[model samples]
Target: MEAKVILIIVTTGLIWLIQLSSVEATQWHSKQLLPYFRRIKLDKTKNSVYQHTVKDAIRMHLRIPLMQKALCLPKGTKVSKHLQYADVSFALIILKSHCFHCVLQLSSDCLNRMVDKARQHENKFYARFTYACKTHAEYSSDCMESGRPMYYRNLRNLVKQTEKCWKL
Candidate 1:
């Protein structure tokens, strides 16, 4: 009986090991078959042009020029012109921030004016405005009100929430 139990355990262990090895082998084969490259192939005329991802491009745009200059890229690397668009909606009264627990109370009329100001302008590459909300506690006030531009945090959670006494 002891030998039978030992044999069963060993057999199960071997089967698991074999399955794991086969999975690793399959992953290796798949990676070799479809390798991912940071630099994708562009048109034949501009063979070596690699475009930065939108998020990275945004970061590079927002960052200081000295930091941007420190990083070197291929001679013709371009920021991807393709932009992702979203129609974001915020509540009329309470504003919930993504992090740092910042909440702003505003009236509906005031919120409408704020939204009007946030509208994208024609011929402008970027909008130059942001909304400011007060933090719940003194601890998160620093993050809510940073020296850097509002785009640095980018209002991670720009959603509406219902709280005690808020507007807009």
Candidate 2:
């Protein structure tokens, strides 16, 4: 009887610990973004909608989990070197989900140019990671202002858990 009681207590304790850890994991994104949040330059001269839209977009991109490891990289780790092992398709996923959402709206020439740029800057891993988010924010704000459904579509497709993207 005593042994069974002890077993139940241990099980309960383990369950509580697991739950606490899960909660911490969810908060990790917010914690990591604190620095960026503090550094945001809110232009008082701009309209409230414009300020909010850009800020929101920046927040959303900075919080992406897959890119977190790359964004807040380890001390002394070179992002370009780190990215050699990273699945390059993550960039594609972002570009496809955001910049290429409305394929019909983009001219073949424009699409080719963007694709060429992404490919051309393959070695610029950290820049690509950080720039993609900042760039997305700017583009996102435009779509939001223009009332393009592309912004909503991009939100829905933002994070697809592919083997390539999820693989660490």
Top candidate, metric lDDT: 2
Give the residue spans of candidate 1 off by over 4 A: 36-40, 44-168
For all candidates in order, the CA lDDT equals 0.28, 0.37
RMSD of 1: 20.3
Note the residue pairs that clash in candidate 2: none
For model 1, the local distance difference test gives 0.28
* Sliding window of 10 residues with minimal summed lDDT for model 2: 97-106
- TM-scores, in order shown? 0.24, 0.35
> Candidate 1's residue-wise lDDT over 7-126, tens digit each?
999999987666555433323322321211112222243212111222342334322111111111122334223211110111101112111122233344433432332221100112
Candidate 1, clashing residue pairs? 92-168, 93-167, 93-168, 98-157, 106-167
lDDT of 2 by residue, 81-147 (tens): 2232132333333332223111112123432332333223221322223344453554345434443
Worst 10 residues of 1 by lDDT: 85-94
